[model samples]
Target: MKQVLHFINGKFLESTSGKFYDNYNPATGKVISKIALGSEEDVDKAVEAASEAMNGEWGNIKINDRIALLYALADEIDSRFDEFLEAETLDTGKPYTIARHIDIPRGAANFKVFADTMKSVADEAYQMDTPDGGIAMNYSRRYPKGVITVITPWNLPFLLMTWKVGPALACGNTVVVKAAESTPTTTALLGEVMNKVGIPKGVFNVVHGFGKDIGDRLTSHPKVDAVTFTGSTPTGKRIMQSSALDLKHLSLELGGKNPAIIFADCDMKKAINETVRSVFANSGQVCLGTERVYVERPIFDKFVNKLKKAGENIKLGIQHDESSDMGPLISKDHQEKVLSYYKLAKDLGANVVLGGGSPKMENGLENGYWIDPTIWTGLSEDSAIVKEEIFGPCCHIAPFDTEEEAIKLANDTEYGLAATVFSENLSKAHRVAGQIDAGIVWVNSWFLRDLRTPFGGMKKSGIGREGGHHSLEFYTELKNICIKM
Candidate 1:
């Protein structure tokens, strides 16, 4: 079996403890690899290496040289595109086409985008007259914020991991990443990319294991200067509490029970197409995926019918099959969790308009973590299915009488990560987008992202923004200098 080992100090190392976690192929329900379960000892080693690099060769590297390395790293990742695509597809069970087109390219782009962004940044400078009528010059410069601990989720593993790593490295901070337990292959593979591109030893590191085992050790470690995590809200809260002792810098992009509001005047074809993608893309594992949909009452029946038909038509086949529209959940445990919610929705009297159970698979795929794309209606706002983040290929639809009601329904949850407004009326779209309490409100589209814009959640969805210059803010510390002239 493939052994997923730690990448520390530019080398792959087994855990000090000989313990291993079985890495499964979600599509086949087979043990594909063994992941080293990192312990506190491993954490300490990674941290020490990261700290040493920050205080040694990497810290003193010139900004121009560092940016060039980042660009080169992006190039190297592109060069090894097929290798990355395979590892990501093997780990994530996402479609090969999805990984080829979206994940791998975006992963490479993260490095390039951040490198270009870091190159273009201009610091602040000011001239002031002193009380004694002398002139003073005040200027600011940014420095790396020491070592960062990056904890990534399994969904979109490669893309999200690089999303943080790109900026962290671009800002010249060393990072110790804790890859999600079920998906460690791509992370292990990244160590090769870093070394091949000539990134300094200890500048990039990866540790594999369950969050409970090594999460606190990494997050609460005295040497770690910051924690950037992408996961659920409760986990984010625990990380916040743990990091509070040191008051470490935190950038958390947590869970979302995101919503989609469809107006009667929306382009029906466009809205249905986009909403289906929003709800079922990546098996609905996207943090921004919509779990609650509100359609204007006049068109509710037609919308539900079309959506049901679309859900029915989604192809759930083997991961390698290019024709497959969807793939399995990340693991059996996650599959069970999503299944429980499906049962609860029915028990709570939800109208199950579509699938609510697993689809049958044959030819060595019988035990795979398969779940049918599901749809529901006639559930109250207080229903668990309506209130919580399922993080699966399912959504509950409801009819709204007015624009005010639609907005209210969209904002009803505690999550403020993302929401979508589908309307032909530009004025109404703008008006509703403004009132929705999400960090990102998409009007007439879904999953369209610009790397230059700020990305994070509001309220409980996330703590800080990251993207473009906002990422620079988190990855570096600013120091101001003043001189009298």
Candidate 2:
């Protein structure tokens, strides 16, 4: 098995205690890599390095220099695109198609966008009129949070980590990133790229280990400035508690059981296709992934049939295969967790229309971490499947009669990260899209986002946003300046 090391203090190092954990490839269920597990002492040393970098080498650099460095990193990432793709695919068990076409490309795009946006915020001008005799100059000066701790998740590991790390670096903060144990290879590799691209030492660091040990040490450390996390809501809640102890500014982009409503006037076939694709994309392990579907009763029967037909066409294979439509959920343990939700939904009177059982491994995929893409219809609005966040490839559908009823059912869940509204009528789509209490709403479209748009969740789903110019606000602090001229 291959072994990966943590990037600490601009060097690759083993654990201080010489302990390691197995990192598996979900597709083959094989131990692909062994990662060094850090202790609190490692966290302390990394934080110390980050603090010095923030105030020493990184602090002395010009703002424009920082922005230019970001552009260079983006170029470097673009140049090494295949390396990231392979590392992400092997580490996270995501399809190489998505890792190459979606995640890596988007990560580069985020840095490129921030390269331009960062310069826009650096020394932006503001003026205030004086009541007395002289004209007054007033503006806000923004700077880094200093030694920010980014605690990331297993699913979509590279993409989400960039969402935090990109803007944090561009906004002038030095970062200590903690990639999930399930997928540490890509992060360690990304750290190598950051160091190679002439970025100052300690600008970016990566540590790998479990949350209960290393993650706890990082978040609870006094030197770490802020904790930005993307993961399950329960873990996010714990991070919040630890952040409170140090009064560190926190941004927790947590879980979701987002809903989608198919209006009576909607295109039934299109809605069914997008709904299935959205929930099952990334094996339903997305924070904004659509977990609940509410279709108008007028088209319920047709929707179910279309869903089953779509299920039969799914191609499950190795992550590198071009023929595969969906890949595994992180591991066998996670697969079982998602299947347990299936049992819960079954006991709640939901009717399974398509798949409910794991498939025989496709070709040589018998040992891979794979599960059948499943869907259920005829569920009541109050069923636990409709209300809870199940981060898996399972989807729940219910029928509603009126537009009001559809809206009510879609908005009933505690999660408000994302939702979709489908309608051929443009005005009705926009109106209902506005009414849904989600952070993001797509009309006849799902998972649509621009790098310039703000992305995040509401209610129990999460706190704060991650993209756009507003995202820089999270990584920066402002000091109001007033001067008499």
What lDDT would each prediction earn against the true structure? 0.94, 0.83
Q: In model 1, what lDDT does residue 158 have? A: 92
lDDT of 2 at 318: 76
lDDT of 2 at 361: 82
RMSD in Å for all candidates: 0.8, 1.6
Residue-wise C-alpha lDDT for candidate 1, range 149-267, written one tens digit per residue: 99999999999999999999999999999989998898889899889988999999999988898999999999999999999999999999999999999999999999999999999
Candidate 2: the clashing residue pairs are 27-368
Model 1 CA deviation exceeding 4 Å by range: none
**Cα lDDT of model 2 by residue, 327-349, tens digit:** 88798888888788788877887
TM-score, cand. 2 vs. native: 0.97
- Model 1 root mean square deviation, Cα atoms: 0.8
Clashes of each: 0, 1
* TM-scores for every predicted model: 0.99, 0.97
State the lDDT at 111 in candidate 1.
Answer: 93
